[model samples]
Target: MSCHVLYGIAGSIAAYKAPEIVRQLKKSGYSVTCILTKSAEKFVSRFTLENVSEEKCYTDKEFWREQNIHIHLTRKSDILLMAPVTANTVSKCAHGIADNLLLNCFLSFKGPVIMAPAMHAEMFENVAIQDNISLLKDRGVYIAGPIEGELLSQDLGVGRMIEPETLVECLSVARFPALSLKNKKILISSGGTTESLDPVRVITNKSTGQLGKALSNMAHLYSADVTMISAGDVSSIGFKYQIEKTASGMHDALHHSIKSHDVLVMTAAISDFIPEYSEKKIRRKDNALSVSFKASSDILKSLSEQKKERVFIGCCLADEDTLIETAIQKCKEKNCDYIIANTASNFGNSKRDFTVVSKEKELDSYSGVSVQEMAYRILSLV
Candidate 1:
């Protein structure tokens, strides 16, 4: 049977994206029903959603006109998705306010809940809104994106809603292959490691740890005991994690922790070279300053040597032409069971092209897939 999605729309200029979101969901084989808040109707029409979803649309008026409607909807739906949820609605959900039909349904929904926040940059970044978002995340609600992009106000920042196609893809991939890794221990490393040049200056790559974060989340969803070693902020991740800012720190953390885990996925961008650190900050000079660089420790290769019965997965970032070849070589050189290969251009992207390779041959490849789906494919092999 197809899964039923109770799609909720709240007040925001981004509400106009609702019809397309519904269309994408239906196209992906989900039966969708939409509910709009009173303020949401000002931006999007019920008729449009009905036409796209081919399901009944509900509003606050229907909440009063019908008996036990919210209860009935929650009983039938497999999941509840709130796209373009505004700060006001976020606050309501956090505070248990059910003044509107959507809020009421959210309160009663028993299944997985996903929310995509959309608003102006300032409003989205407000302390109250962040606190509300944190609360929802703690309650196991999946928050998709308020990714950086152009807003309705013609300014570019971090309040734009993710596109409809990506949202649907993430939701679809999250549902299946359920609990496949239950009771398994998985260790993941993420973010770009820094190499200090001086007390005040350091060199780091462009990795934002988005892919690692996605992998960790997917592993947790599959019921794996997950421990993340991250070089970036760990505030948003819900599972067990430790912060490791430099290559040496990450190496020590992983080596110490990998003994107990069954699998190790090395997604962290560890620096290949480390510069000679200066105790004092380097002063500016007209002439070019030269620094000596030494090779850093090979964390993945070293871990693979001591893997014993544990599976090791490594990642290779290269140009498109050599991505697969490099990954295959790395798999053998690092003694990895699997290697995920991608282009450097795909760094920090929501959707990216990936090719999974093993020591023997290529396992699977995908184009423009969400990180959630990529993580699912990688775990399925294990």
Candidate 2:
């Protein structure tokens, strides 16, 4: 409520909606000031924005003012909120083309910045634009939706402005200075690791990697640099991804990533065994095929020596009766700072119950119908 927000508006049809966002943030007790680019003035009047923000709106004309408005605004604001960020603006920001007042401040501001992009579908989908978005994301920017809905052209795809209400909610998520994971790098391994029997066939579990994906998103929300290494669906919020095919491959991938991260979230359902792989298609020989197996190398066990200072979080799935004890043992075996275990039945289900243990002692248990609960639990430990 006591926060100062610098709201930047770019040239786009969605610029008309900027006033609503400023009004809402102001209502929430944020001291909102608006910065409108030259092109943005065509869509939204400066007088209107100033009326809603209850503060004077600045434009490119102020860029050369002797008062040094850009630097002052950059240092004064607690957060920078850019709404209706056009593709042109996005590309310029990404390439360090600070030709406008808003971008000038954006370059100098040392606070959190949230970008809500809006443009034509094709422009938004352009490879260059996506790459720029990726660049901003790597810099720890929180990007809200350019949700799919009715575009001003009456065509619908992915380039619509996120409603002001949703923008407000997302901005609140970025307001936590106390819980900020500003300088930490978090590595998460997720998804069901697949082992190959042949080029045409694979061995995999029912895990869909939703928990890992959720945790990655939550970690981003806390401003941590997130890297997801997985064999399944993963988000590239940060600048790293390691997709492995077999258990041994997954093991190698995790081990390669261990030393660079401050915290390791190992939720990957890595296969325990791998069948002897065939170079070619293993045609059914007389309808009787024999397969041999060997245990995959343990990823966590190999890292015990190096995990003394860094935080390691491990997850185990076990039979109901052995869940708690197994989780405790896993923490000791893996040198984990914390361990979570749940019944094997909860592996592929949407609802899950997890028993949390830390430092060889039982912590509390968490049960939820949504992955948000687990994400919160993991963040609390971090």
Candidate 3:
């Protein structure tokens, strides 16, 4: 694969490391192009970058359109990186206030962009800065760290820029393994489904989707093409929990998106019932109020009945009683390869107790394991 890298420089003491970063990128078999902000030029000279990268160093937005360089450069590069990104640059990028050439390039680029922030520990921990990071994450930007070390002012704490070698190593480690599930497409349904009671109000379960998110990330780690359906309003527990949000505009994502995967993991704790007649506004209450309830659609049963050689995994939650038998019954009823049955009262809140039930034999009970470990065990069964 021909890898093209765009190096975006920001104002920091670490800006002096730009040349080394470019050299490392080149050493790793990447074609490097450097984009420098004005503040960055104070530390690293443009001539140094031009000599290292053998390409033009762009600092002016007018120069970009003057020669159509930004568009061409963006198209040429497969990955864009902003190392030693200052707080100001991150805020601008996060809010889309692209005044300079580099910022404009970030705004217009379509490739995977990774940022490594450098700032004082206090500034890095500032609420606004953290919110800017969150905004970038919501927009699907990848971030490296402002590692801990000595500061420019002779102070010591976090917010030191990660070194060039570290950055390159991180880039090359390969987040997803090579073609492990080469031709397999996987569908994962996660998070709790809302049962609408009104236009503004709904009945929903307490599923945080920690398990489903873990499975999706592991699937991606194994190089499976994964699509995680329904994850908005739920927090993912780890780095593996990266999925494009497709549930923002609609409810019941499982029924709508269940048909296109080689493996299906139904880890969502779907609401069992919903109001039969939902009101547009909240039901006005003086004292006590009640609404008629009915069963919502059974997403897993539909998929199981329509299965065509796809592996299916289902989950069952029991409160205080009937863990093993209920789980086994669910396995048979759903025609799934495995059933992950655990307690509902303490599930996702604390370390859970679970038993893996298959057609041949019920596995021994395991407990005190974190949700992530449980997820790993479940994936191992496949």
Candidate 4:
């Protein structure tokens, strides 16, 4: 079934991003109803929203219609998404002030509520706004960013709307907690580890930790206790991190925490080999140098001691011909519940196309899937 999303946009420079939010949701097969504050019209026009969302954009006048707009919307919406939520509206909603159709719908809706704040740096940093945000959070509203960056004030600070991709990811995570990972412990390792060869150089893969962060965010949305062991800085913020600079360190971190979590997702592109290192930086010299290399133990192979039935999901990079076979083999070898065989074509792309397999055989395959959707699928499998 398609999720019904009532998207509310407030008065902020970030309102310009509203259309893309709607578009992405629709692309993900969501039914969206847009609500706009009167002041929001100054930045984003109704015509634009209507075109993008393919639904009527409601305003304060909606309540005057024969139908009770708020009640109607409340009954239909599965999630109330307030994006680019200005500080003004944040204060209003926090105080139970239903001055507009959006707030009216907000109060009437009983489902999940997701608010992404966007405003001037000064306005966001104001004590009143911070308190209001806290109040909303206390009321069980999921709060996204207001990430720190260039604000509408032409100054850098903690007041920029999070990107549409992140907002979309957050919305998906918030909308469906039915597959609630409530009380389940998730230990995830993400990003690519770098092995130091010298002070000036190291070996690392192109892995950016995008999928790991997505999975963690989804797990968090479902109320799971998540601990991420990252190879370096992860893309998503707000997760507890255990940073490891080398493949050996990453192996140790996972080995230590593997027992505590119900699920383990190994997405880090760890170095297969590490070179013997010199304590001092290799100086530029006339003589050519050759460093001896040694194979590193595979992290997944060492999971034999884990108790049976612990869910393990692993990702492998390989060619199409060997993909499914490799995934199935690895699944059995590592005792993984499921495995994803991703081809080289999607190395750094926003969308991933891969085959999902179990130890015995191929279960399913997904193509052209967003990282957000990827997170959703993995959770469903779990």
Candidate 5:
């Protein structure tokens, strides 16, 4: 059976987006039960939520009508999510106010709680609200976002709730226990490295870095100190990262950053071959052009040579016939604690098939799993 999510909607102008969040949760194969605050009903109806979630929607009326409703809901839920959670709701949840059913549910729910705050810029930035958010965060609540965007007043700022799709994605990843990496530091590399053949020409791969981004987000959710080395834009990821466009650049960055980290996840697709550099763009003439290539340095092998107390996770891409064998061989040859093996088809896909192999033997294999879930499974091994 799929996991059950107890979704709470609070009073905010963004409440209209709540039904879509329910729809997204259901679409992601999560059974959803929604609860709405009295204030939230002003913007969205319980009927709409019930229609979208395909489950009964609870409200304050149910709080009085039903016995131990909050307890029952909390007990049945695998996760609790509050999207477009207003400043009032945040304060109430932080202070243990339970006048409403949603508040009661929040107070009673013992599982993972994810909140996406939405309100006016001023309200979200107020010292009181900030303090409440910090308190909840300290208590292991996962705060998704109050990202910068257009608010109810048509003003642009940081009080806007993230989109329903992103909120669902956050919920998917945040289902894991909080503080799983409390005292650990992780270094990760992402994207496909570029090897320049000329001023304007380069060799690159099809890696979109989505998995790397997901892994980084998962690491942050688990409370790990994360540093990313990327060959692509990671501005959306709120972490410390350095840009490295070439294989050599990524190699150097990893070496510099690996010393302080307890774990290294090598997800970058470094070019296998580097062409001889050309200072200027090669002219297209009648003569057939030929380029000579040299193999790029093996970053993982070199780094593993100096591995002392650190854990190394390597990723390998191989043909189906040799996938498991290649992963096993790479795990031993590169001295990796674990190696994740996949195929070229998974390069830019959100759902991927993966096999995890240790130096000793194959550990586990998953088919058609989200990158977020894959990240969680991989980290669980560490």
Candidate 6:
């Protein structure tokens, strides 16, 4: 089915760029409908937007009489986009202010919404905007960026709207989330599992969990249900990491919660060993401390043995020998259908050089792609 995207423009100096966004969406084979806030029209003329969109721009109190445009448009769109979303409009959206045609549609509609915020650095940094952004995220609203770069005015800082192409990439249905596992369910495990050594210390790995989260998000976009279980707090701040707890209690919680999911993509760098005797509180008297550790339960192997019908995918990152051999061995030992193998040094980096090893195929490689693309490719494979 062809995708239809509703573009909402708010008041901002960046409004002038809205037409280009519409044009790009159209070029990408999306049916585009543009909605203009009254404030936005002041910055970019309706004539320009209407001319580019080739569709009537709605922005009036008499919206219903003018062809019941709001409902009709809402029913037709697959996604809603708010570009150059100003601080004022974001606050209004956060607080459920349906004072305008654009806001009214946003409040009443049920569809994926993406926002690309633009404003002064100070206003964007305001607590209110931050709270609103968080609120929107909780509601499953996707945000492209207020990516940092030079601003329209002289001052250099963040809050500039992301370029149209980047926005298109996020919304693009044509080229992403590689083909193998599209429309398939994928579960991912990320970060290093912490084994409490003492109250203050834990045994953990250097894993940053970037690979797993990237894979999770990409699988999600490809119409797969994704569950991410991490041993550490992953946030997007550095590598789009989000803080997630990995305490023993939390692990149990996740284990109990998982149901009849089909695919389990295990990329998490789980600790194989834990302290033989962990104290509830800190052990203070330090005198050449020696702690013995026993191997923890093999989560992937156990799951593979228990769930025979599901597809189990594993990751093996090695530093010494040829990665393909290690990945194949790991795949066989773990009873996984596929293994994504790469160098340990490639972890937490922008570019990924990895190979896909499955029972049916010897090797297929992907590299020099964003962690996101790497994820998409992996998901496509199944």
lDDT of 3 by residue, 315-336 (tens): 8887647877888888888888
- lDDT winner, 2 or 6: 2
> Root-mean-square deviation of each candidate, in angstroms?
9.1, 9.6, 15.7, 5.9, 4.0, 11.4
Per-model CA lDDT versus the true structure? 0.85, 0.81, 0.72, 0.82, 0.86, 0.72
Q: Lowest lDDT 10-mer window, candidate 2?
A: 233-242
Q: Candidate 6 overall Cα lDDT vs. reference?
A: 0.72
As a whole number from 0 to 100, the lDDT of residue 48 in candidate 3 is: 98
Better of 2 and 5 by TM-score: 5
lDDT of 5: 0.86
Q: Which stretches of candidate 4 lie over 4 Å from their true place?
A: 1-79, 83-100, 107-113, 117-165, 172-178, 235-237, 283-289
* Least well predicted 10-residue stretch by lDDT in candidate 5: 233-242
Q: 275-295 in candidate 2: lDDT tens per residue?
A: 888888989779798989898
Segments in model 2 whose C-alpha atoms lie over 4 Å from true places: 1-114, 117-178, 285-288
Error of 2 at 137 (Å): 11
lDDT of 6 by residue, 1-382 (tens): 6888888999898998989999998897888888888888888887888899888777764474676567878888888888979888888888898778888878877877778889888888889898998787656666666756668668887778878876675663233422434345556778876677777786777788777766754554443555677777543211122234444543453454345467877777776776865667655575667789777667776666555677787888886467787788888888888998888777678888888997555578876877767777667656
TM-score, every prediction: 0.63, 0.61, 0.51, 0.69, 0.79, 0.56
Error of 5 at 268 (Å): 1.4
Candidate 1 lDDT by residue in tens digits, 276-367: 99999998788778889999999999888788888898999888888888899999999999999988877878788999999888888899
Clashing pairs in 1: none
